[model samples]
Target: MSANTPMLITFVIYIAAMVLIGLFAYLRTRNFSDYILGGRSLGSFVTALSAGASDMSGWLLMGLPGAIYLSGLSESWIAIGLIAGAWLNWLFVAGRLRVQTEHNGNALTLPDYFTTRFEDNSRILRVFSALVILVFFTIYCASGIVAGARLFESTFGMSYETALWAGAAATIAYTFVGGFLAVSWTDTVQATLMIFALILTPIVVMLATGGVDTTFLAIEANDPTNFDMLKGASFVGVISLLAWGLGYFGQPHILARFMAADSVKSIPAARRISMTWMILCLGGAVAVGFFGIAYFSANPDVAGAVSENPERVFIELAKLLFNPWIAGVLLSAILAAVMSTLSCQLLVCSSALTEDFYKAFLRKGASQRELVWVGRGMVLLISVIAIIVARDPESKVLGLVSYAWAGFGAAFGPVVIFSLVWKGMTRNGALAGMLVGAVTVVLWKQYVGLGLYEIIPGFIFASLAILIFSKIGSGPTAGMLERFDAAEKEYQDAHL
Candidate 1:
């Protein structure tokens, strides 16, 4: 048999299983809510793993490792920042979002929450927030597609376009059929595959380099600077890397995991589980890249795949170190990462269009059955757009991820923070904050040459905008305040 046969078989099996899960979820999806948000019935295990799975995406396997492989330990600063940011997001945002989303008209989408949170009868908040989701998520989805394309191209020796569509096919299949429930459940399975691959790959790499001690020696021989976290660091560069954590607040896909939890009471357990998985997986990714330096340095003749594109470090290493059967499973982990995040993103985009745009304006009295079909249609629509965006074979996963991450973080992070905590936050305040945050990120990214990441300025400006606008504009109405108070009370009650 050809060397690629086992890998091909493994890939086919994984995709088939995901589609079967989607079929199962489809049978249980009785309404639009279940289709989009799993009817808010996810348990702690599903919620925790799904959130982590969706948040990490293909970047965990491809982009972050690549960055570390290219620049050494300094790149690990991004991982540290993510740990801090994810912890804070879980502690402050998860439970509150779960409860607040429920209390305020049982909001199934962020746009739905915003509309009811401040009682925005004009529906401006719903329209704008949905637009923001669609815009940034399209770019975000493209990053996942790019990562998938790279995987297929490297493994099967296919062209970029062929790999792109081939990689996207299964994801679209399961996601289109099953919706949120399928995405979440499949994410749980995918999360397990991802962690296993990350942990085992690094160990194999360490062994291939002789041993831990020998690996370090080889790394030192290659360039001792690889061990220094501050080897070529700048203040702005470090801060920019860390700022990735902030994006967690505004991530529609990750936040969906929080909202779909069975109850706010599930949050503490879920948070604990999520952080543990995240830290281990992140540590493993760092190890893979760091140790890969030694392996590649020692075997420069076989380093062409990774040398050409650092993102393929993990893929190249897996193929080289493991037997064909084991390598197939390891490679499937990359697909797991890609599918988990891409499915959630597609579902979120569909929700924004179906629940926020279609139902809100186009068909206020549409049947639940009709809405589910509409959501599925929107999923196809967004995937095509994302595919177009990802057509450029030169696109880098990390670069694409960073831009969309900044856009969402700067635009929605402050707004989510202020809205949940402060009853005083008015609709105009949210509008202003979203505008300032998004605009600041875009302007800073395009025009500013400063060493700072755009999220820093965008977040700062957005927070100020919320405070200033809330003070100047009329405060939230009596009904909005009552809902906020009730949600807060419920949150305190849950903890107690």
Candidate 2:
């Protein structure tokens, strides 16, 4: 047996345990509700941690770290923006979404909520929302697959294609079996593991470099600009880039957690827990990246010293600081971040396809069993497509995630936020807002090439589309407004 066989065995066992948990979750799941939301019984910790873990994903491990390594402390503004945006989402959006979704009799997906809330029993809203989810989520899920593949290729010396398939298969197996409950439970565990790993790595790296002062001096001496937050990037560029936080208002997976929370009362606690977790973990990830650059720069001749691919910062540090046994566990945390998100996104996309599109229109009579199978089939198909897209090793994880994130945020974020707050938000206005927001993001990413500054354009276009369309377009029907009023009243009374 190979000397490293124990490490491989441990990794395999960890993955097997995840799949088994999903299988067990499936066995215990009695109905679609159980599969999707665990009967909406998640506590504050589970909901907050799952939501944060799923939200951060590969971006936390690879993208954030790489950003710090490349751009220095200026990247911290992104963390600041995200934390602020997430706080607002929890404060304003979470309680309302959770209560209103249940009050409206929507149980399954975001499109389901849209149809129920707006009284658009017609198929147009459902189909449109489903299409948007599918389009953006495919690219979003592909970015995650790319992160997973890169982790495996860099750390385990696996082929990129092989790594892609392995990662996809693991994520798909669990999500397909366990559904939302499994995803949430696994995410809770994964999120905790991620926090531990994130914290431990940077402290170890700092000790390896003497201390913070020594590390900073080394980095500053190596490249003075690395110490400057906004030295290279312009003021406008910084604001525009950090505004990526605004996109969170519209993200389906994150908002889905808001909708699925057990109650409005859970939101405040969830918000506090989630915000604290995001700040610490994201800060730790950035430190890992910056410290990685310092560590490697100081010791260029260490065995397996990685230089060019700054993304390897985390993996290389894991290997250098720990034995293969502990490194394997640490490596799984990276995979955990990637898989937790991929699983959630895949299920979300599949639900949109199966529930929103297939059942809503194509086959109204589709049985739950048949729909379940369809969702599983869609998961497989999407995984295959993501694997195909993840072949390009040079594809930047941050850039891809940023584009997808901005697309969802700009297209859906404003509409979701305003729809909840404004009684007069019309269906046509919402539609227009979503279309313009999505189209604007795509055009900006493809044609504008504004680098980190693209998110601002998308956000402005989306917000304007919502405001203008609601003002000029046909307002909601009297019946729709009446229903909205009733739902709002019921929500208030229930909370009160």
Candidate 3:
């Protein structure tokens, strides 16, 4: 219809493929478990890719790049922190959580896991954790929506309002149809596209500017601090940036990949694959940002829009450097990164609604088929809410993401780590840790106004709360401690 016809067509075909994958998954989904966790049947590669895709989100393509574009190498500490956190998560939390969740009441969701893990008969853990997830994930999902909106608006010449809703349509359709299986399979494909795009774009941009040496000349001439990793960096800033890795221990969507793995033996392989992919993808993302400084500096006319909105660096570069078809595919990779995570978040929210709230509180005997439809319905509902939340054209993807990441990291990170290792963790302690972690994050962000990131304080306070409350409140019963030991033994035995 216009000059953007090819890109639009590429996007259409990609979106259609995602929907078809969902339909295929729909056929295989036999019960609620299959819909929520894909019957715990994912292999190592799929598990790794899905986890990476979901965890990285549009932050990988847009937010991270934008940060580097604006702030230079100093912004890269976030990536380093994320990589370290991801490695630790895979190493310490993955296999143990997989074995423990399966043994501890076969929990289907994070809230369910918290409830069963602590043996809380009162259901406070389920309700509170579910509420926390719904609150933060709604914001998290909105960030993904904002990323998609930016992609569509930049790539197709659409208004932000139209792009916002349009971007969510395909993600909701596929997630509503296929459930977890569809999300995972589509995530695998999207992950490959994202990696290819990130790798190819940076290589092209680097060559276009002559080479690394020439690119550095351009960047340094334009702004010297772009090369200085420690320029204007403070001790507090460095610690705050590095603390992002702590978020990994409590990310429900990433942890879901571990829960859905076909077996504990699959974890080590999955972890290796995931870390390798993460390193490559994160490096590529940072390269795009760093090289963008050189590319834009050399071409001021083309950099007009990007200078104003740094987040558009990736999209603008693809358009300027590549032919229409190639750019379409590259832009599709941005869409891939956005959709992959949004769909996973929506599905996880759906599971929380269906399994955690709907069934837990209402319609206790709902059939598997009915539950499946309800999950689908919630997926649509949550997507609409996220769309509404993303209506602010001024919303920064990274800003929203940082808040939600801190919320989850502070609320659940310390509690998750302690619960997994410390058999003495009581229900009151878990509750105290979650409440203190979440509340402190809020207060620190809103009131403290300390230049430091909230997660640093929130995480520390939460860990202290758990330790203190565990001592003051009733400790875990002997039976619960025995079960914890048994699960720990089973995990170690399998690894051996």
Query: Among these predicted structures, which one has the highest lDDT?
Result: 1
Error of 2 at 424 (Å): 0.6
From the highest TM-score down, the ranking of the candidates is 1, 3, 2
Looking at model 2, report the run of 10 residues with the lowest lDDT sum: 393-402
Model 1 stretches astray by more than 4 angstroms: 395-401
Q: Which candidate tops TM-score?
A: 1
Score every model by TM-score: 0.98, 0.93, 0.97
Reference-based lDDT, each prediction: 0.92, 0.80, 0.90
lDDT of 1 by residue, 1-496 (tens): 9999999999989889999999999999999999998999999999999999998888898888998999899899999999999999999999999999999999999999999998889999999999999988888888888889988998999999899999999999999999999999999999999999999999989999899899999988888898999978998898888988998898888888999999999999999999999999999999999999999999999999899999889998998999988999999999999999899999999999999999999999999999999999999999999898899956554365667888888888999999889989999899999999999998988899498989999999999999998999577788898989999999999999
Angstrom error at residue 175, model 1: 0.5
Taking the tens digit of each residue's C-alpha lDDT, what string does model 2 give over 1-496? 6535655776788789889889988876766666666668788999999899889887788778888987788777788888888888888788777866776666478788777766775657778878888877887888888878777676667888888887778788999888888888889989988999899999999999889999988888778888787867777777876687887888899887877688777888899999999989988998998887788778878724455766777877887888788888888899999999998899888888787878877898977678777887888888777766677756564356657888888878888888788888876777777788888887877888655556577777777877787788567877667766776786677567
TM-score of 1: 0.98
Pairs that clash in candidate 3: none
User: Model 3: runs farther than 4 Å from truth?
Assistant: 394-401
Q: Candidates ranked by lDDT, best first?
A: 1, 3, 2
Residue-by-residue lDDT tens digits, candidate 3, 1-496: 6658878888999899999999999999999999999999999999999999988777788889999999899999989999999999999999988988988889989899989888899999999999898888888889888878878887777999899888998889889989999999999999999999999999999999999899989989989999899878998888888999999888889889999999999999999999999999999999999999999988888888888889888988988899877888888998999899898899889999999999999999999999999999999889888888799856564365667889899999999889888988898899999999999998999899568889888999999999999898577888788779989998999889
Q: How many residue pairs clash in each candidate?
A: 0, 1, 0
Better of 2 and 3 by TM-score: 3
Model 2 off-target regions past 4 Å? 1-3, 303-305, 392-401, 449-452, 490-496
